[model samples]
Each structure stands twice: as C-alpha cells, then as structure tokens.
Target: MVEITLKGITKRFGNFLALDNINLKINDREFMALLGPSGSGKSTLLYTIAGIYRPTRGRIYFDDRDVTDIPPKDRNVGLVFQNWALYPHMTVFENIAFPLELRKVPRDEIERKVREVAKMLHIENLLHRYPWQLSGGQQQRVAIARALVKEPDVLLLDEPLSNLDTLLRLEVRAELKRLQKELGITAVYVTHDQAEALAMADRIAVIKEGKILQVGTPNEVYYKPKYKFVGWFLGNPPMNFVEAEVEGDYLRVYSSRIPVPSHYREIIEKLGIKEVILGFRPHDAQIVKGVGDGLLGEVYSFEPLGREQIVTISLDGVFIKVFAPEEESFTFGEKVTVEIREDRIILFDKEKEVALEYLYKD
Candidate 1:
C-alpha cells in the first residue's frame, strides 16, 4: 500500500482552470473518495493521480518518492473505468489473466492467481463465460479482477458503478467495498453520488470547481459542515437555508424570531455576526404546536417516501423541507409551527458561505 499526496496541484486548459491549487493526502490502505458534481474536477484529479494527465503545476508523491512525471504503466496503479472494458472474445479467466500474462508470469502461476482472484471476487463459476455472455455486474467484477490480478500498489476507480442499473449498482457497490477491505488496497474512488461516497469511503473529499471544499468523515461533513456548500451537497433532501438576522441573543428567521439557545450565546456574541444564514437538515426540523419558538409556515406539499415523508413548507415565501415519519402527515396550505432544535441548527455567514462556530457557555 502507498500513501498518495498531491501538493499545490493545479491544472488548466488554455484560459480555464480545471483544477485549482489543491493539496491532499490519502493514507495508505485507506478507501478515499473524491465526490462532487460533474464539472467539479473530481475526475480530473483522479486522472492526474493515475498519470493519465500531467498537471499544469504540482507534485505528486507516492509515499516518499515524487512521481508527478511518471508514466501510467510505471506507476503500478490499477485503473478501472465506468465501462467494463473487457475483451469481448476472451473468457473471464483469460481476461483476468491478461495482465499477469503481459508481465510474463509462468503459466502455472497465472492459473493459480487467476483462480484465486476469481474465487475471491465470487466470479470463479463465470470464468469460462465470454464478456458478452455475462451480466453487467459480472462484467464489472471481471474488470475489477483484472485490475487486481497484478497486485497493484494502489487502485483508481472512476465511477465504476455508474454504468449498472440501480439495483445492480447497489450490489456492485457492496461487493466493491468488501473486496477493497479484504485486499487492504489503498484506493481512490471518484464518484458524483454522495450516498456511494458516504457508504464506501473512510473519508471523503468534497470538491467544487476543481477545489476541495472540505474533507472529513461522513458524520463530520453532514452534521458539522465547515461550509454551507458541504452541508448542502451531502444530504438526500439537502439542507434548507433560511435568510436571517442575528440580534443580541436571538436569530430572526422570516416573521418568527427565537432566542439563540443559551449554549450557543457565547459563540454568537463572540462572532458578532449581525446577518447570517440558518441551516438545518430536513430531519432536524419538526412540526410543533401552539406557536412554539419556531418558524410559522404553511405546508406547500408533502412527498411520501415509504418510511418517511418530506414535508415542504413555505416560510416568508421560502420553501423548506422537513423529514417526518410516515405516521406524521400534514396537508397543503395547513398552518404548522416548525421547531428547529437549537443544537441541530447550523449557522453560516451568508456572504462567505462558511460555517460559524457556536461557542458553548457552561
């Protein structure tokens, strides 16, 4: 396993910057994911690390050695793409053994390694099948097995599950995670799917416009987002942001003004922020009664999602969603009091889009 490091990485195409000055360290044997939107430079960074693209400026290091200029073949990295990229005429066994064969492994050793990896990936029974004869998931496994057959120092996957259908994607995702853990391979996985990153990564680097916004565990990024963008990017229903003003010890959201919880008073006071954006997850906003210290909004619509419902409410013309159990139902145009648990409230500077720390008073 090798720790991959990128320092002062920058990439440009003519006048457009594809990747900004980016610095990241991925630990050895760690499953690190680069997640962002389509134009967010996640794939660009992956290709740079894989030696497929030379950076406009920056140095890449594997462990202690600089490999910024190394060729892809000499990097000892296995790259799996979105497409299965299997040879149509070769059987699964021959495809998996192709890499070892290229490396000139003896015939007996190739057979042993091919069977071992095939069994490990649970594709041994399908080894005799041609690429056209196998299902999408099976073909994906064959691609992965081919990548692993060489015992690469690191593995790079660029949206490897995107080609599969929803159910097959889920199945392959589980299998990929299992295989990565079992082999203890240091892997860099690039995906735009937030759920996939949340489920598979030991740590995720959220990127936008070729720069990293934040890098943290799923919980940290979700619950304690350092930036509003990070918070808005990771959740299923996404986070709701309400424009608000900070006054003395309270925040005024729409027509409803509530005192900032006592615990956060010190931080609010220290920051001296007069204007801020209030952020809260859908799950954190609840419906309460009797004009509690919460926003007053009318339900606009509700989407039933099996176990829970996403309730959309309008506060001062701004729509906000709340996740409630299926048992909790609200009707359109119904007046409802929305209670935002103070502890779950995330504050951001509207202009900077950066999270503001809450100072707790004892």
Candidate 2:
C-alpha cells in the first residue's frame, strides 16, 4: 500500500480555474473520498492523481517518490472510470486476465490470479460471458476485477457506482467496501453523490468551486460543518437557515424573540454582532402541539420517506423543513410550533458565510 500526497496543486482550462491550490495527504490503506457537485473539480483532482492530467503548478508524491511528471503507465496506480470500460468482445475471464497478460505473467499464474479476483468479487460464474451479455452491475464488477488483477498500490475510482440502479448501487457499494478492507489497498474515490461518500468513505474532502471546503469524517461534515456552504450541501433535507438579529440577550426570529442559552454567553460576548444567520438541521427542529421556546409556523407540505417524514413549514416568509419520525402526523395549513434545541443551534456570520460558533455552551 502507498500513501498519496498532493501539494499546492492547481489547474486551469483556458480562463476557468478548474482546481485551486489544493493540498491533501492520504494515509496508506485509507479510503479517502473527494466529494463535490459538478464543476467543483472532484474529477479533475482524481485525474491529476492518476497522472491523466498534469497540474498547472504543484507536486504529487506516491509514498516517498515524486510522481508529478511520471506517465500514468509507470505510476503503479489502478484507475476505474465511471463508465464500465470493458472490451465487449472479450469474455469476462479474458477481460480480468488482460492486465496480467500485458505484464507477461505466466499462463498458469494468470489463470490463478483471474480466478482469485473473480471469486473475491463474486463474479466467478460470469467469466465465460462477454460484457454485452452481462448486467450493468456485473460489468462493473468485471471492471473492478480487472483493476485489481494488476495489484496496484493505489486504486482510484471515479464514480464507479454511478451507472448502477439504486438497489444495485447499494449492493455494489457494500461489496466495494468489503473488497477494500480485505485487500487493504489505499483508495481514492470521486463522487458527486453525498450519500455514497457518506456511506463509503473513511474520510471525505468536500470541495466547491475548485477549492477544498472541508475534510472530515462523515459526522463532522454533517453535524459540525464549519461553513454555511457545507451545511447547505451535506444533508438530505438540508439545514435550515433563518435571518435573525441579536437583540440584547435574545435572538429574534421574525416577530418572536427567544433568550439565548446562558451557556453561550462567552461566544455571544465574543461575537458582539447584531446580525447573524441561525443554522440548524432539519432533525434538530421538531413539531410540537403547543407554544414553546421556538418558532411558530404553519405546515406547508409533507414528504414521506420510509421511516422518516420531511415536513416543510413557513415562518414569516421563509420556508423551513423539519425531519420527524414516520409516525408523526401533520396536515397542510396546520398550525405548529417548532422546538429548536439550543444545544443544536449553529450561528454563522451573515457576511462571511462561515460558522461563528455553536449556540450552546460546552
């Protein structure tokens, strides 16, 4: 296994800056995921590490050796593209064995390795069929098997599960995680899907507009986002943001003013600002039957999602979504009070769009 590092990496396409000055250190055997929306440079960063795209400025290192200028063929990295790029004419066995054959392994060794990888990926039974005859998930498994047959020190996956259907995607995701753990191979994965990254990555690097925004475990990025953009991006229903002003020791949302948690005295004292953004997750706000130390709103709509329900409500002119258990019921236009736990509140600088502090005292 090999640790990978990118230092001061930058890339540009004509007038567009595709990647900013990016730097990251990926530990050996760690499954690091690069996650962002399209045009955010997640794929470009992956290609740079794969030697498919040379950075405009910066260096890439594999373990202790600099490989910024090395050709992809010599980089000893295995890359699986988003498309299952399998040769349609070749049988699955031949496809998986192609890399070993190119490396001049003996015929017996090629057969042995092919069988081993095939079995590990649970595609051993499909070896005699061509890519055209197999399902999308099977073809993806074949592509992965071919990459693994070469025994690369670093594996790079570019949205490897994007082509599969939802159910198949989950199945493949589980298998991919299992394979990575059993092989202990260092991997770098790129994806626009937040759910996939959250479900699969050991640590995720959230990128936006070609710059790294936040890098952390799934929980950190989800619950303790450092920036407003991160809070807006990671969650399903997304975090709710309300325009509010600090009025003395109280925070005013719309016409109602609620006292700030006493524990946050120091943080509030440090901020010393009147205008701020109140950020809280949908799960952090709940519907209550009566008045409470929270905001009052009328339920606008509800979306049922299996065991949980997402309810949208309007406070003043702003809409907020709340996640609740499926058993909870609310009708359209029904009056409801939202209980926002002080400990779960996040305060952000309205101008900078950055988190200022947690609302509650530690």
Candidate 3:
C-alpha cells in the first residue's frame, strides 16, 4: 500500500491555472474522493498523482519515495479512466492481461493473474466475451479487473460509474467500496457526484476552480463547514442563507427575531460581527401550524418525496425548504411558523463569505 502526498502541487495550461498550490496527504490504504463540479480541476489532480500529467511546480511522493519524475509505468499505480477505455476488438481476458503482457510476464502466469482478478471482480464467467457483448455494468467490471490484475499498490479511478444507470451505479458503487477494502490498496477516486463521495470515501476533498475548499469526513463537511461555499456546495437543496443583523442577544432575520444561543454568543461577540448570514439545512428546521416563537412564513409550495416531503416556506420574499414527514401536510398560503434548531445554526461572516467558529462545543 502507498500513502500518496502532494506538496505544493500546481498545474498550468499556458495562462490558465489548472491546479493551485495543492497540498494533501492521502493515507495508506485510504479511499479518498476528489469531489467538485465540472471543470473544477479534479481530473487534472488525479492524473497528476498517476504520473500522466506532471505538475508545473511541487513534488509527488508515494510513501517516503519521491516520484515526481518517474514515468507512469514505473509508478506501480493502476488507473481506471472515466470511459473504461476498453478495446472493442479484444476479448475480456485479453483486455485484463494486456498490462502483464506489456511487462512480458510468462503466458501461464499472465493467465493466472487475469483469472484471479476476474474472479475477484466476478467477471470470470465473461472472460471470453468481447466489449461489445457485455452490459454497461459488465464493461465496468472488466475495466476494474484490467486495472487490478497487476496488483498495483495505488489505484486511481476517474468517475468510473458515471455512464451506468441509477440502479447499476448503486450496485457497482457498493461493490467497488467492498473491493477496495478487501484488497487494502490506496485509492483516489474523482467524481462530481456528491452522493458517490459521501457513500464511498474515507475522506472527501471538496474542490472548486482549481482550489480545495475543505477536506473532511462526510459529516464534518456537511454539518460543520469551514466556508460558506463548502456548506452551500454539499447539501441537497443545499443550505439556506438569510441576511441578518445582530441585535443585542438576538439575530433579526427579516421580520423574525431568533435569540443567539449562549454557546455561540461569545464567539459572535469576539468577532464583532454586526451583519451575518444565517445558514441551516432543510432537515434542521421544522414548520408548525399558527404563529409561535419562530420565523413567520407562509407555505409557498411543497413536493412529496414518498416517506418525506420538501416544503418550501416564504419568509417574506425569501424562500427556504424544510423536510416534513409525508403524513404531515400543509396547504398553499397557509400561515406557519418556521422554528430554527438552536444547536444547528451556522453563522457566516457576511462581508467575508466565511464561516465563524460558532459550532465550537463546550
């Protein structure tokens, strides 16, 4: 297994900066996911580690060995491309054995390694099938077998399941995570899908426009983001932001007055932030019938999602969504109270667009 490290890595395409001073340590046998939106430099970062694209500045290391100048073939890293990159003319066995063949392993030994990896990926039965003859999921398994047959110390995958259907993606995702754990190989997976990173990675590195914004476990990045963008980018329906003014011991969000919890009062005072953006997730707040000690809003609209429904409430002109159980129903233009969960509130510096240390625990 290899612990991959990038020290001040930077990449440039002429005047365009693809990566900007990236520093990360991916642990030995860790499943690390590079997650972001399109054109966010995630793919470029993965290829840099694989030795396909050398960085313009900085060093790449495998464990303690410097491999900045090593050729990809000598790096002992297996890479699975986004498209699977299978040769249509080759049989499954041939595709999986190609890497071993290039290294001139004995014919019998190549067959043994190929069969071994095929069995591990459950593609042994499809060894004779050509690429054109297999399903999308089958093709993906074949691609994985091809990468794993060499028993590489580090494995890198670039959105390997993006082409598969929803159900197929889920199945392959579970299998891939299980396979990685079973083999105990250091892995770096790249994807724009938030759910994939949350489901599969030991740690998630959230990137944006050639910069890593945050690196943390799914829960940390989700519930305790360091930046407003990190909180905004991670959640489905994302996090709701409202303009507020700090008024004595309370925050005046539009017409509602929410008392600042004691835990966050000192931090807020220390920062001397008069204006702030209050952020919260959909599941963190609740809607109640009639007026109470909560934000006054009217039910604007809602969408029923089987077990639970997403209800959109209008705080004056601003809208925020709340997750409500399916059994509880609300009608349009109905006056309701939106209650904030005191412990779940996130405070962001309005001018800096950065999160404060309000989540600090006693």
The clash count of every prediction, one per candidate, is 1, 0, 0
TM-score of each: 0.95, 0.95, 0.97
162-277: candidate 2 lDDT, tens digit per residue: 99999999999988988898899999999999889899999999999999988999988988787898888888878899988888889999966777767555777886878888
Model 3 segments more than 4 A misplaced? 358-362
Candidate 3 lDDT score at position 206: 95
Give candidate 2 misplaced runs (Cα > 4 Å): 261-264, 357-362
lDDT of 3 by residue, 73-131 (tens): 99999999889989999999999999999999999999899989999999899999999
The residue pairs that clash in candidate 2, if any, are none
Worst 10 residues of 2 by lDDT: 353-362
In model 3, what lDDT does residue 61 have?
Answer: 95
lDDT of each: 0.89, 0.89, 0.92
Task: Write the number of the candidate with greater TM-score, choosing between 2 and 3.
Answer: 3
Q: What is the lDDT of candidate 3?
A: 0.92
